[model samples]
Target chain A: MPDLLPENTPFAIARYTPDELKAALRKMYLIRKFEEGAEESYTRGLIHGTMHLSIGQEASAVGACMALGDADKITSTHRGHGHCVAKGADVSRMFAEFFGKESGYCRGRGGSMHIADVEKGNLGANGIVGGGLPIAVGAALSAKRLGTGAVTVCFFGDGANNEGAFHEALNMAAIWKLPVVFVCENNKYGMSTSTERSTAVRRIATRADAYAMPGVTVDGNDFSAVSEAMDAAVARARAGEGPSLVESMTYRWRGHSKSDRNRYRSKEEIADWMARDPITRMADMLVEHGIATREEIAGLEAGADREIAEAIEFAKTGENPKVAEVTRDVYTEAVQ
Target chain B: MNMDAGTLARPEQETRELSYAEAIREAMDIALAADERVVLMGEDIGVYGGAFQVTGDLVHKYGTDRVIDTPISELGGAGVAVGAAMTGLRPIFEFQFSDFATLAMEQIVNQAAKVRYMLGGAVSVPVVMRMPAGSGTGAAAQHSQSLEAWFAHVPGLKVVQPSTPEDAKGLLLAALEDPDPVLIFEHKLLYKMKGEVPAGHYLTPIGKAAIRRKGTDLTIVATSIMVHKALEAAQTLAGEGIEAEVVDLRTIRPIDRETVLGSVRKTSRLLCVYEGVKTLGIGAEISAMVAESDAFDYLDAPIVRLGGAECPIPYNPDLERAAVPQVPDILQAARALAGERV
Candidate 1:
C-alpha cells in the first residue's frame, strides 16, 4: 500500500492517499452502474418519463465533484445522474424518484429530470439548457454575501455554451468575483450537432476568454487530468479569486435521450468511444499505479452492481404519491 | 383573501402623503433596514436611482452590496434573484419596464415559480419583482404594456397591480414577508400620483378587493389604472341617478372571488374593466367568474367587459388614449349596464 508513483505524477493521483483513490474509483463505478440500472428499468417500463443518461462521462462527473463537500454547491444539467451520484446522493432515493414514488427526492413530482438534495448542496438538475448557469452564480453570490466561504460548480453541456445565459452568468460571476467554477462537459455533440458545426471556437473553454477568466481543456476520460483541473479552479474560487471555466472533453456512448434514433452518428463512432471506456481506463490506472490489485477492482465493480440491484428494489417498493395532494407544494406554506 | 388587510392605520400609526413611486421606495427602504437578508438587483438601480426613480438614493444608503446594479441582462439578473431567494437571501428584482419581463419569463415562470414545487417544497423563492407597467406616457408599444395577465395565468406566481400609493407600499412590504414569488405591476401613470401612506411597516393582504365606492344599481369591477377610471365613472353615474359600486381588484391572481361575487349579488349588474387586451384578459376572467357563480342568477342584464383595444399601444397620443379603457369608456359601459338593457 506504499506510494509507488514519483513526485512528477499528476497532482490528483499523487496527492490522493491510497484509500481516497479507491473511493474515487468506486464512485465512477457507482455512477456507471446507476445509469445502467436506470436504462434497464426504463426498458422494462418501470420508469414513466424519459431520462438522459451519462454513460461515457462518469470520469468528468466524479472528478469535478472530488473537490466539493457538503458546504459547496453544484447546479447540474439534464444529463445529471452521474453528477448526482458523484455528489454523495443515495442511489436508492434517486431510483425511488425515477419510479415516481412518494419517498423520492421530489415526492414523485419531479421525475428523472429534477432530483435535488439541498442538504448535500445539490441544487437540483435542470431540464433547460444553460438553466443552471445564472442560478450557480446566485448560489456563489450567497456564499460570498453570507461569508460561508463555499464555492459552486456549474455543470453544463457544449450546447449550453451558445445560450445567452452562459455569457451573462459568466460575466456576472467574473465581475462580482464570486466563488464559482463553470464546468462544461463537452461530449462533442449537442444532440446531433457537433461543436465544430455549432460553436465558433474549436474548444468550448476558449469562450471563457471573452469573460476575462482563466479557461482550460482537459481529457475528460482521464480521471487525474479532470480532477487536477477542477481542483485548481475550485481552489481559485474558494480563495475569492473569482470563477474559472474548465471544459472536459468527453463523448456520450448513447444517444442524447431515449427518443434519439442514433441515425445522426455512425456505429463506428460509438464503438470508438466505447473502446476508450472511462471506467475501464480508471480501473486499469488503479492497477498500474499499484493502488488496487485486479481482484480489488473487481470487488468494487461487484459492490456497485449489488448496490444498484438493491436500489431498484427499494424504488419499486416505495409508495406512490397521493392523487389528492398533487397540487401541494406549488407555494411554500411556511413563512420565512 | 388569505390574510387580513392592513388598511385603516392604527391610532398610534402616523401617515404622510406620498407618491406611488415614493411609497414603493419607502417599503423597500423599510425592508432593507429591517432585514440584512434583503437585497435589491436591477439595471441602473444604483446611483441612477432606478429608471422610474422608485429606488431613489437607496444605493447610497445601502451601498452596492445590497442595492446591486446588474448589467443589461434581465434573464440572468432575474435568475440570480431567484437563486439568491432559494439560498436564504431576499432579492427584490426590478424590471426597467414590464415589457422587459418577456426576456426574463424563463427565469420568472419556469425557475422562480416552479422551484418550490419542482423540489417538493424543499425550497421557497421569496423573491419580489417590481415592474413599471401600463401605458400613458407615449413610450409606445414596446415599453408600454399591462402584462400582469401573463403572470396571473401561472399558478405558482402571485401577481398584484397596486393602483394607489397605500396599496403600493403595503403590498410590497407584504410581498417581502411572504414565502413565494410575487410580481408587483406599478402602473407608469400611478408613480407620481400621491396618497396618504402609513409611516411604517404594514401589509395590504394579497388576494383582496377594496370597495372604493358603494352603490345599489350596478357593480364596476376594475384593476390597476382602470380602478381610478371606474371610480370617476361611478361619480358620474351617481349624478345620473344610477348608484354604481366600484371594486378595485388589487390582486390579479387569486381573484378575491367572494368580494366580487358579493358585490355582483348586491348590485345585480357587472361591468368588468382592465387595461390588458380585450381577449383572454382579466376582464374575461371576472366575467366568467360572475357567470359561473350564483351571481349569474342575480344578474339584471348581460355582463359587459371594457378592456384595451385589440392592438399594440400606439405611438399617437390620441390613439393611445383610445387604446385603453378611459373614464368615458367606463362611464358609457356603467350607464348601459345600469339602464337594465339586455
Candidate 2:
C-alpha cells in the first residue's frame, strides 16, 4: 500500500525506546493478526457468534494503554480485542474464550464480547454502547475511596457519545473529580451511521465542555500523537484533576462485522484508510528514525504470526465445559 | 420444674421500637459504621434525607462522602454502583420509587445480574438497590409499583421484600453482606408501622420463610404488606371456626420451597397473595412450585392466588384500595377455599 502522508512531513517520535517500540509494535501486530484469524475461524464455523474488529484502530488501543500504570483499570467496548491485547491479556486464553473452550478467561461462557481479566485490572468488555463509561467511573470511585492511586481509562466509540450513559457518567466523573480518562475512538461510523449523520456535535471531544472537562482531539493513526494525549490525560487523573475526554480520529479498514455489506461507504474510502494503516505508519517511523532495520520489523511480524498460530492451536485443543456444571459461579459464595 | 421457674430468670436484652423506615436507616448506619468501603448514593439522599426520609440523618452521621447525593440519573447512578461493586466498594444505591427502576433496568439487569456469570465468576457485584414500592400514598401509576417480581425473575439477583421493621433491618443487613446484587423492596405503606427491632448487627437469613401463624385448615403464603393482611384474615377466620396458617415469604427468588411445601403438606390448601399484579407474578411461581412438587398430592382444593388488579394503581383512594388484596378479600378467599361458603 502507498504511504498516505507526504515524505518529510515530520513523523512525530514516540517517547519509548527502541526495544519498547518493538514490543508495542508486536502487540499491535498481534491484535491485527488475531482479528484476522478470528474472522477466518468464523468463516470456518470454529468460532460461533459475530465479533467487532478494531483492524485499523490499533494505535489508539496500544498508545493509550502504554500511558497507564499496571494497576490502572480499563473498561473496553465490543470492538475490544485490541484493548485486551494492548493491556497484556494472554493471547492463548483470549482465543480459547473466542472458541468457547472451558479453559478460556470466562470459562467458555463469555465468548468474545464479554471477556474479562479482573486480576489485570480490566473490568470487562461490554456489548452495550457506552456501557463501560459508568463502569469506569465506578472503578475510579473505588480507586479514590480506597486511595489506590490508580486511574481508570474508559474506551468507547463515537456512537457512544449520543448515549445517555455517556452524559451521565461524564457528569458524575466531573463532579466528583474521579480519576478517569474517557477515550473515544471516532472510527467514522457507529455500526453503519457516520459520525456526521448521528452525532450532533462536530467533534465528540467538544462535548466534554458541557461536562466541564478538558477535551483533546488527535490523529489516532499516529502512535506519537495518541500516546502524548493519553499521557497528559493519565497524569491529570493521577493528580486528581478529574476526568478528560481524548477523541482519537481513526477509521476501520474492514466492514463493521462479518454480516455487513460494503454499501455504507465507498471502496475508495476503505482504500484511503487502509493506506494509512497504524502498523505500517509505526514501521515506517521506526525505519526512518534508525530505530530498527526493515529486517528487524519483518522479524516482529513473523513473531506475531507464530504466536497467533500457537494461540489458535491451543484454542482448538482445549476442552469444552461440562453440561452438569452450567449453573456454577452464577453467584459467589464469599458473602453468602 | 414449676418451683424453679421463678428463680431461674434470664437477663433482659436491650430492645427498641422503630419504624420500618428507621430500621432501614439503622441497617445502613450499622453497615456504614462497620465497613469503610460501604457508601450510599441516590438522588436527594444526602441533604434532603432521601425522597421518603428512609436515609434520614445518615448524611449527617457518615458525612457527604459516604452518604453521596447523586444527580437525578437512575441509569448513571445504578451503572456507577455496579461498577463500584465490581471494583471494591459495597455501594447501597437507592431509587426514590420502584417505578423509576424501569429507567435503570439496563444497568441492574444486564450489567449487575449477568456480569458475574458472563465473566465466569471473575468478579462479584455486591451492590444493594433499595426501592420503596407499593401503593397507598396516592402517588398513582408512576410512583406506586411493586416491581420485586421483575428482579426476582432474573437469575443472578436476590430479591427480598421486608414486611416488618425487624425484617427490614435484618434483610437489608443480609443484603449488604451478600456477594451478588440484592434488590430490597420496602413497602411504602409499611414504612411508618411501628415494631420492636433488635439492637445492633443482626441478619434475617435470606432464602428462608417464617411461619407467622400456624393452623390446620389452610395455608396463606404472603409477602410485603400482604403478610400483615394475611395475619389479620387468619384471626378473623378463627372466629368463624376455620383455622388458617400464615407464612411470611421474606425472600422472593429463593422461594423457601421446603417451608412452603411443608406448610402445604400439613394444611392441604394453599393461597398465594402478593401486592403485585396477579398474572405471571410471584404467586404464579409459588403456585407452580406447589403443582410440580410432591406436595401436589396433598392438595384437597385448587390453589388460589389473590394479587393486585390488572389495572394501574389509581389516584383515587377507593380505587387504589380496591386494586390490591385487603384483609376482607383474604378472609373471603379463605372462607371459600376452606369450603365454608360458595
Candidate 3:
C-alpha cells in the first residue's frame, strides 16, 4: 500500500517489482500475439471486416495504461486492441466480438471498431477520428461530480490532433479541471497521410500549451519512458490539478487496414519500425534487469500464444446472434 | 366548513397559466429539485439566460454547478453531454439554434444515437437536447431553420415538438425520465405562447398525438408551431362550412400512427403540415405511413402536404412567411382537400 518506489525513483522498471515487470512484459506479448492471430484469422476468411492493427505500437498502449487501475477509464481509438488488452480485458470476449458472436462484449452488435467493456472501464473504441476526446472529458466530469476519484485516459491518433473535437475537448477539460489525460498515439500516419502532411504543428504535445496544460513527448518504443510520463500525468489528474497531454511517438508496422495497398510508404520504412518492436524491447529489458531469464521471457510469450490460440477457438465456437433479436439492444425499453 | 347539499367538491390538482419558456424552466427546476443527477449545460445558459431565455434565472437558484455555461462548441459540448448521460449524469444540452445541429450531427447521430445499440445496450445515453427551431424571429437561414426531420430519421433518437406550454413542461419531464436520448425541438416563435399547465409533476407521453380539434371534412396533421397554424386554419374552415380536424403530432419519430389513422379514416382525407422543407421532410413520412396503412382505403381524396419552400428561409419578412406554410396556406390546403375553393 505504501509507495512502490523511493522519492527520487526516475525510471519505471526501477520503480516496479520483479513480478510487476514480468507481468508488463507478458501483456506486451499478449497484445502482439492477439493482433497476429487476428491477422491470421482474416487471411483464413474467418473474420469479415477489415481491422486496424496496432502491431508495433504495443509499448505505448501498455505503458500509457500502466498507472491506471480497474476504476480508471479509457476511451480508445479504432486501432485499440492493445488498449483493451492493456486495461485488463479478456481476449476471448474480444475475439468473440471480432467474430460477431452473441457472447462477445457487444453481443455481436459492435465489431472490432466499437468493442467496449464498461465493467472493465473500457468506455469503447471509437470509429470516428478524435471521437473519444470529448467523451473522456465527460467521463472525467462525472467522476469529479460523483466524487469517484477516477481518472480517464483518452487515446487518439496524431491525425486527431487536427480535429476540432481535440481542441474543444482539451479546452473544456482544462477550464473545468476535469480528471483526464489526453494520450496521443503519434503513429506517424493517419491512414496514408503522414503527420508532416496532415498535422499543422511539428509536435502534437506542443499544441497542449494553448490549452494551458503541461505537455510531454517520450519515446513510445521505450516502455519505461512512456510509463514514467503517464504515471505523472495520471497523478496530476487524480490530484484534481487538471488534464495533461502525453504524446506517445510510435509507429504501426502493418498497413492501416486490411484494404490498405501499402503504396503510400516504402518497404524500408516498414522494416525500420518493425526492427524496433516494442515487445522485443520490453522482453530484453526484463532480461537485462535480472527480473526474468531468456527462457522465462520465452515462456511468457508461449503463454500468450496459447491464450490467443484458445481465444480463437472460443470465438469460432461462439453462437451467432439471432435475427429476431436484432433490435433488442437498440433501446433499454422494448422497441415499440 | 360544511358544504351545502348541492355544492360540488373542489378539485385537488392545481393548474396555472405559463408561457412555453416558463413551463420548460419550471420543468428544469423540478428535475433539479427532485434529483441531484440532473444538470443543465449550454452556451450562455447561466447568467445570459440562454439565447432564447428559456433557462432563465434557474442558474441563479441552482448555481453554476447545476446550470452549466459551456463555450460556443456545439460538437464537443454535445458529445460531452452524451458521455455524461452515459455515465449516470442527466445532462440537458441546449443548442443555441436548431440549424447549429449540423455542426454536432456527428456526435448526435453517430455517437449519441448509435452508442447504445452499438455497445449492445451495455450503456444508455439519456441525454436531452433542447433546440429552438422554426423561422419566425427573422434569425435568417443560419439561425432559423426547422431541422427536426433530420433527427427524427435517426432510430435511436426520440424527437418531440411540444406545441403548447402544457406539453412543453410535461413532455420535457417525460424526456428526462426516458432511458434513451430525447431531442426536444422548441419552436422559437412559440416561446411566448401561453397555456394552462398543470402544477407539480406530470408527463405528456412520447409517441402519442394530441387531437386539438375534431372535424369531419378533412384531417390536417401538423407539428411544432404549425400545430397552432393548423388549429387557426381549422377554425376558419368551420366558418366557411368546411369542417377540418387538427392533429398535433407531439412526437415525430415514433409517430402516433393509430390517432392519425383514426382521424384520417373518419375524415376520409389527409393534409400534412410542418415547417420543415417539403421534399424528404417529416410530412413525406406521414404521407407514406397513411398510404401504406389500411387508412388508404378510407381516403376520399389524395393526400396533400403543406411544408417549407425549396429554398432556405429568406431574410425578408414576406419571403420568410412564404417560405414556410402560414395559417392561410394551411387553410387553403385544407379547403382544397375538402373539395372547396381555396
Candidate 4:
C-alpha cells in the first residue's frame, strides 16, 4: 500500500490492501482533474452559478472520506465536489447538476452549492460559512439515536471555526458524545483574511481542549497522514467516545473559487505547496513501491479523463427541472 | 382549514384551571405517553429538565432517547428534528425562546416548512417546532418576538397559537397528526393559567380560529397573550353596558375567516389585537379580511387595530410593556371603539 504508514506516524494501516490504496489515489486524482475541468468550463460559461473547487485541499477530503464506511454520513462545504465524489455520488448527475439540469441531485434547483443525495449520506453542500456543521451534527445525532453506529463527518473551512454555531455545535457534540468528527480544511484563508490574522488560537485543534475531545493537527498534504488521523477519529466516534476535531493543515491549490486573481497569496507560497502536490506525490510513491506500474497509472489517468468527458456529455444532453420541481424535497408531502 | 365558531367555544373548563406552562406540560406528557413517534429535542431537555423547565422530569421518566437534550445550537437541534421527521419518526422541537429561532430559520422556514412542497409531495415534514413566543418574562428584545405573521406568509406552514391550557394540549396533539410542518407559538404568560382539559388523545384542528366569548357590542379578534387581554377587555366593557365578543384566532395562517367575520357582522364594530408590531402585523391581515368581506356593510365603526408599538421590544420593563399592547391597552382601545370611555 505504498508504505502508507511510515515508520514515523502513529495510526492504523495494517488492513489496507495495495488495491485499496491505488483506488483511493485514483479517486483523488479523478476529483482533482474533474474539478479543474469544471473550473475551466465555468470560465468559458459552460457551467452556471458559483464554483468552489477543492483543488488544493483534495487530500483532506479524500483521506477522511476513504476512512468512512458507505453507511456513514458526510456534510460538506460549498467546495464539496471532493466529498461528493468520495462518498460515491454519481459523477454524471453531479456534472448534470453543474450544468443546471433536472437529472441532477437537486434537480438543478440547488446548483453546485446545494447539491445533495441523502441516500448516499451526502447531506447537501452548504453555502453559508459553517452552515453544514449543524446538519452533520444532526445526522450524527440521528445515527446515535437509531443505534446505526454510522459516523457523520462534517467538512468545513477554517472560516467556519469562527462562527458561533461552530462553538455551539462542538460543545453540544462533546456534551452528548455524538458520533461526529469535525474536519477543518484550514486552507488558511476565510475569503480574504488569513487564519493567522483572524483566529487567536495557535492551533485550531487546541480549541478542542474546551470540548474535552481529542484535538489533532494532521499533515493534510500527505494523504496517508490525513487518512490515519481520520481513521482514528472515525473509530473513536463509532465506539461512542464522542465527537473529535482534526485540523487539517492544507492549502487550496486554486483560489477560493474560479474567480480569484491570486492576490491574497504569493507565487512563491504557491510554488512551495506545489512541491508537495498530493496527487503527484502519491503517484510517485505508488511506482517507487511497485504497487502499480507507470503504465497502470497512465491507464488510470486515461480512465479518469474519459469518465469526466462522459460526465460533461451526460450533462449537455440533460434538461433542467420542470418548473414545478423547484418546490419538491424541501419537505415531504403526503400524496393521499 | 376553518373551524366552526360554535364548535370552538366548547367551554374552556367546566371544572378546573391550569397554567399555560402546566397545560403545555400536560400536552407533552400526553403526547409522549400516547404515541411512540412523538419525541422532544432541545437544549437542557435532559438532565436540566429543559431550559424553561417545560420538560420537567421528562428525561428521568422517558430516558435520553425520547426526551433528548441537545447542544446550544438551535440550527442543529432543529435540523435533527427535521431529519427525524422526514424519516418515519415524528419530532417536536423546543426553542429556548422565540427570539433564538432566527438562528434556525434556515432549517425551520426553508427546510422544514418547504420540504413537502419541494419534494413534489414525495415526503412529508410532520415536524412540530414549538417556541414560547411573545414578551412577559422581561427577556427583552432579543428574547421576544411574535413572528407568526412571517410563517403565515409562507404557503405550506400551518401556524398555531393557543391562549388557553385546553387548546394548548388539543392543538399540539392535532399538530402531531398533521402531515405538514406546524409551528405552535405558546405565549410566555399563559403557561400557568389553569383550566379543565380532557385526558387522553384529542385534537384541535389546525388552521382553525376559536371564539372565546360571545357579545354583540363589538368583535375583538386577538391571538396569543392578546386573546386573554381581549377577554378581560370584554368583561370590563360588559359592566359598562358595552359588550365585546372575544375571538381567539388560534391558528394564524389559514385563519378562520368565517368565525371572525360572523362576529364582525353581528357586532358591526371590529378591533384586531396581536402581540406583533403594528406595522404589517397579523392584525393587518384580519383588518384586510374584514375590509374585503361582506361584513363591511355591517360595520358601524371604522375597523380598529391594536398591536405592539413600532420599536424593538425594549429591555426596560415599563418600556417593553409600552411596546406591546397590555391588558389595559385592550381595555382602553375597546372602550374607545365602543364609545363608552369618551
Candidate 5:
C-alpha cells in the first residue's frame, strides 16, 4: 500500500481505505454532476418549478451520510439532492421527479424538494425550513421504542437553526435520549441574509449546549473532518447517550434558487469558494495517497458524467402522469 | 332528560354508562392494551393524568415509556408525534386546550397534514391529536375558542367532533385505526355528561353524520357542545306546532354531505348551530354544501347560522353565555327559521 498521509491530529487519521475513498469520491462527483445537469435542464426550460441545490456543500452531505448505516434513517431539507444521493436514492428517479415524470420517486407528485426513497430509509425531503428536525426525532424514538439498533440523521440548513421546530425537536430528543444526530449544514447565507446578520449565536452548534448535548463545529468542505465529527455523533446516538449537534460550516456556490442574480455576494467570494471546491480537494487527496492516478480521477468524472446524462435521458423519455388522476393521492382514501 | 327521546339505539354488547371523559380514556386504554405500537404523548399526561384528567392512571398502567409527559412546547411535542407516527408508532397526542393548537400550526398543518400528500402517498401518518374544545366553566378567550373549523379546512387531516359519550369512545378508537392523521375535538362541557358506552373495542365510522331526531318542518345541524343544545331545542320546538330535525355532524370533513343534503331536502329549511365563530365556521361550509347541491331548489327560506358572536369568550358567566349559542339561542334560531313569531 502507498504511504498513508501522516496523522496530523488525534482524530485526523484517514478513516477510509483506498477503495472507500474512491467510492466517496465517486459519490461526491455523482452529486455535483447531477446538480449541474439539473441546472442545465432548468435553464433549457425542461424542468419545471424551483429547486434548492447543494452544489457547494457535497462534502457535508456525503461525509455525514457516509458515517451512517443502511438501516439508519435521515430527514432532509429543500436543498436535499446531495443528501438523497448520499443516502442511496436512485439518480434516475431523482431526475425523473424533477422532470415531473410518473416514474419519479414520488410518482411525479413531489418535485425536486420532496424527493423521497422510503426503501432507502430517507423519510422524505421537506420544503419547509426546519421541518425535518422533529421527523428525525420521531424516527429515533421509533428505533428506541422498537429496540431497533438504528440511528437517525437530520439534515437542515443554517436558517433552520432559528426555527422554533429546531429548538423544540432538539430539546425533546435530548430529554428522551433518542438516537438522533442533528446535522446543521451552515452554508454562510440563508437566502440573501448572512448567518451573522440573522443568527444570534457565534456558532450554531453552541445552541446544542442548552439542550445538554455534545456540540461540534467542523470544516464542512473537508470530507475527512465532517466524517470524523459525524462518526462521533453517530456513535453517541447508537450508544444511547442521546443526541448531538454537528454544525458543518460550509458555503453554497450557486444562488439560492433559479431567480438569484448573484446580487447578495461579490464575485470575489464565489471565486474564493470555487478555488476550494470539495471534489477537487478529494481528487488531489486521492492522487497524493496513490489511491489512484490523475487519469483514474478523470475516468471517475467521465463515469459520473455518463450517469447524469443517462438520468436526464430517462427523465426526458419517462411518461407524465395522467391529467384524470390529478385529484388522486390527496387522501389515502377516495372520497366522494 | 329531554334528549332521551332522541337517543340513538345503543349497541347490545355488554354496555355500561360512562362520562364523556371516561369514554375517551377507555378508548385510549383499549388502544394501548391492544397495540404495542400505540403511545400517549402530551403535557402533564403521565403523572398529572393530563390537564383535563382524561389520561388518569394510564401512566401507572403502561409506565412512562408508553404514556409520555412532554414539555410545555406544543410545537415540539406535536412535531415529535407527527414524526413518531411517520415512523410506525401510533401516537395519540393531546393538546391541553384546543386554542393552544395555534402554537403548533406549523407541525399540524405544514408538516402532519401535508407529509403524506407531499411525499406522493408513499407513507401515511397514523397520528391522532385530541383537543379539548368549546367553552363553559369560564376558561375565557385564550382557552375557550372552538378551532375545529381550522383543522377541518386542511385536506389530508380527518376531523371529528364527538358530542356523545359513546361517540367519544368509538370515534377515538376508529381514529386510531385510520391510516392517516385524525383530529378529535372533544367538547369540554360534554366531559361530565353521561351516556351508554360499549365495553370492548368498537368503532364509530368517521365521515358519517348521525341524525339524532327525525323531523319535517326544519333541520338544525350542529357540532360539539352545540349538538346537545340543538337536541334540547328540538324538544322545545316539538312542543310548538313546528318540528325541528337535529343532525349531529360528528365528522366535519368528508362531511356527510349526503345526510346533510337529505335533511335539507326533507326540512326545506336549514339552521347551522356551532360554538365557533359565525363567520367562516363549519356552518358556512354546511350552508355552502346545501346551496351548491340539488337541495338548493328545495330551500323554503334562506339558510341561517347560529354560531358564537364575533367576540372573545368573556370570563364572566353571563357574558360567556351571550358569546356562544346556548339552548335558548338554538331555540330562538330554530323558531325564527321555522317561520314562528318570537
Candidate 6:
C-alpha cells in the first residue's frame, strides 16, 4: 500500500481538479494507444519505413504541453508522436503521414517526423536529433523581436543533449534572453545506450548552468509534477527571464524504433517501470480522490478507441502524391 | 617628357582604378550607411577586419553588433542568417571560403531557400552569402575550388561572380535589395584588379549578362576573372583577323542564356571558358544549349570549350595557368574556332 499522505514532504503536489487529472490521464492514454497502433501498423507493413514511438514518455509530453497556452509552441523530435498528439495535431493527417498519403501535412514529403502547423503552434517535428533547438531559438527570437508574448518549447531526447547544436542554440537563447523552454526528455537511454553511459553528468539539467539558465529535474511519470515544472518554466520565459532547461526523467516502454527488438533491459526493469505507468497512476489518483468512477474512464477509453480506429480508416484511404511532386517545393521556382 | 604632360596625365580612359577588395569595402560602407538593416557577419569579420581585409574598419565604423564576429560554426551562422532574414534584418553572411559552404549546405539549400515557400509565401529571405572562390592564391585543394555551379543549380538562389571592381560594387548592392538569397563569388585573383566603380549606391540586375566587347566573329562566354582574360584574348584575336565578342556570364544561375544565344546568332561561332574542370563543367551546359537551339547550324567551327584541365587545381603557377584558360589559351581557342589560326 502506498503512503496516503506524509506530514513533511519535499514539495506539495499543486492542486489539480479531478477532471483536469482525468483529462491528463486520457491524453496520456490517447498518445499511448495512437503510438501502439502506429507500431503494430508498421510491423504489419501498412506503414512504410521507420516510425519512432514515444510509448513511455507520454506523461512528460502531455503534462508539459498542458502547461502551455494555445499560442505557445512545442517543437518535436523524431520520436514525435506523443508531442503531436499532446499538441493536438489532427489524428487523421498524422495517420495519413505514416500511411504515405497525399492528404498528409507535408503531402507525404515529411512522413512521421515532420508534421508542422505554425497555426497550431506545433513547429514541425525534426528528423535530426538536435535540429529543433536552433529552430526553436529562431522562433523565440522572432517572438522577442516582434514583441509577441508567445514562448516556444523545444523537445529532444538525451542523445541530442550532447550535440553541438544544442549548446549553441541554448547559448544564443540565454544571451538574447529569449522566451523559450528547453525540454530534455531523459528516458535513461539514447537508442540502446543508457544516458548515464553516454552523458558525463548525472543529470541533463546540470549543464544549464553553463548557459546561465535555470535548470530543474522532474519526475516525468507524474503529470502534476511535470505540469508544475513546465508552468514555472513557461511563466519565466513569458516574463522575459530567458530560457530554462527541464530534464524530464522518463522511460520508454518500447525500443527506439519500430525495428528495435528491446534486448537492452531485463524483464524486472520492464515490470518495475510498468508498475509506475503514468496513465494508470493518474486514473488511480482520480478514483481515490472521488473525482470520477472507473465506468466513466472506461467509456472515455472506448470513445478514443473508436475515434482512433476511424482516423486510421480515413488515413488508409488517403492517396500518395503524384510522382511529379518531386520537383515541387524544392524552392519558390516561379518567383524571380 | 611628353609635349603636353598635363594632357597626357589627364587621359579620359585613365579613370581611378581600385582593387576588388577596396571596391567590396566601399560597397559595404555605402550599403550599411544607406540601409539600417544591412549587417555584416562572419568569423573574424568585425575587429579582425575580415579574413582577407575585405571589410576593413567596418567594425570600427559600424560597431560590433552590426559587424558581428560569429563563433566557428558555419551551420550556426547560416542558420542564424536565415532566421534573421525572416525577421527585419537583411544579413550579409560571409563564408570564409567556398569550401566551408559544404558544412552549411542544409541551411543554405533547405531552410534559406525553402522557408518562404514552406510558409505559403508568408515571408522572404533577403540573405546574401559572399564567398571567396577560385584558385591561384595557392590556398590548396580544399579551398581553391570554384563552386558557383553548385549554388546556381538551386532555383531560389541567385549567383553573382563579379569580374571587376564596378560589377562587384553593383552586384553586391543588387543582391542586398533582391528578395531572394544571392551568393556572390569573389574570385581570389580578381580582388586586386583596379577599375573605376561609380560612386554612391549602384546596382547591377541579377539576371542580365554584360557584353564586355562587341564583335561578329565568335561569342566568348566567360565568368569571374576569366572575363578580363577573355577581353585581353579578344584584343589579341582582333590582331589575327578574328573579331571575337566577349560575353561575361556574370550571373550563373539566372544564367544570361538569351545574351549568349543572341551573341552567337550574330558571331556565328561560340567558345565557353571557365576555371572549373572540363568534365561536365558550365561549358557543357553552354554547349548543350547552343546545340539544342537554332544556333547549332550557324557554327563556323565546333563549339570550343577552353576549360581548366580535369584535375585538381594545382598550386604550381604554370600548372594553374595551363589548368584554366589564360589569355594566350583563350586567344588560341578563339582564333582557331574562328578558322583564322590553328
Whose DockQ is higher: candidate 4's or candidate 5's? 5
Per-residue C-alpha lDDT of model 6 across residues B1-342, encoded as one tens digit per residue: 001111012223333568889988888998889887788878788878887889889999988767877777787677767766755578898998888988888778876776554433445678899999898887667888888887777767888898878778879988988887899999988887777766677677777788888889889899988888888887777777877788888888777778888988998888999987777878888899899998777776788888778788787787866767788888777767887432
- How is the predicted docking of candidate 1 categorized under the CAPRI scheme? medium
For each candidate, what is the lDDT?
0.90, 0.90, 0.90, 0.80, 0.89, 0.79
Q: Indicate the residue-level lDDT of A110 in model 6.
A: 71
Better of 1 and 6 by lDDT: 1
- Worst 10-residue lDDT window, candidate 2 chain A: A1-10
Residue-wise lDDT of candidate 3 within A133-206, one digit each (tens)? Answer: 98999999889888899999999999899999999999999999999999999999999999999988899999
lDDT of 3 by residue, B279-302 (tens): 999889989999999999999888
Residue-wise C-alpha lDDT for candidate 1, range B1-342, written one tens digit per residue: 111122333324588889999999999999999999999999999999999999999999999999999999999999989888888899999999999989999899989889888887778899999999998999999999999999999978999989889899989998999899999999999999988887988888888888878889998888888888887777777889998888889998778898999999998999999999989999889989988989999999999999889999999999999999999888887877788756
Give DockQ per model, in order: 0.62, 0.64, 0.81, 0.24, 0.78, 0.20
Tens-place lDDT per residue, model 2, A267-300, is 9999999999999998988898777899999999
Q: Each model's number of backbone clashes? A: 0, 0, 0, 30, 0, 0
| Cα RMSD of predicted structure 2 | 4.4
**Residue runs of model 2 more than 4 Å from their true location after superposition:** A1-14, A334-336, B1-13, B340-342
> Can you give the TM-score per candidate against the true fold?
0.97, 0.96, 0.96, 0.86, 0.97, 0.83
**Model 1 root-mean-square deviation:** 2.5
Query: Could you give candidate 6's fraction of true interface contacts?
Result: 0.11
Put down candidate 1 lDDT per residue, A245-328, tens digits, no spaces.
Answer: 999999998899999999888999899999989889888887877789999999999999999999999999999999989889
Question: Could you give the candidate ranking by DockQ, starting with the highest?
Answer: 3, 5, 2, 1, 4, 6
User: Candidate 5, which segments miss by more than 4 Å at Cα?
Assistant: A1-6, A9-13, B2-9, B340-342
Native-vs-model 3 lDDT? Answer: 0.90
Task: Please state the error at residue B332 of candidate 5 in Å.
Answer: 1.6
